[model samples]
Target: MPIRFTQSCPTCGRRVQIRASLIGYTVACQHCNAEFVAEASIDDGSGTTDSPIGVEKIAVDPLMARVEEALQRAAKERTAVN
Candidate 1:
């Protein structure tokens, strides 16, 4: 499994997940579509990489999350088709 961590985009300042192995490589931000070198963020223990996304989990509705997952999957399929 690829180890992933969140890093804020330098352009839009939006948090984006970057593979730990991708550090020092060019990566594109999902939110801003800006390209920059990926870096591993130092965890302050406030949100450590040991946990999901380096943060304590926020309780999420299971059904809603499943629906959102389906929607995102469908969107990806649509994008691929185009």
Candidate 2:
């Protein structure tokens, strides 16, 4: 059996399982069609690479965003009143 390691898709945050042989090779995400490299280190599992991963898109809840904005507005108003 081939060894496999797990990583998240930079675009869609989907879980990806890569074969050990494919390390240092370029790969495309099946979920979002985003391209990235199958990078890994043999010494440790820190998952660090010289190249940085790009985030194409991220999903967020509208309600959470509204709540965050409201909190920011409230803080600004409070500061102005003080």
The model with the greatest TM-score is 1
In TM-score terms, candidate 1 sits at 0.52
- For model 2, name the residue pairs that clash: none
Residue 82 displacement in candidate 1 (angstroms):
49
List the candidate 2 regions with Cα displacement exceeding 4 Å. 41-82
The sequence of per-residue lDDT tens digits that candidate 2 reaches over residues 1-82 is: 5456556777888878777557668888878889888754332447543343221111135665565578779999999999
In order of appearance, the predictions have TM-scores of 0.52, 0.46
Cα-based RMSD of the predictions, in order? 10.6, 15.6
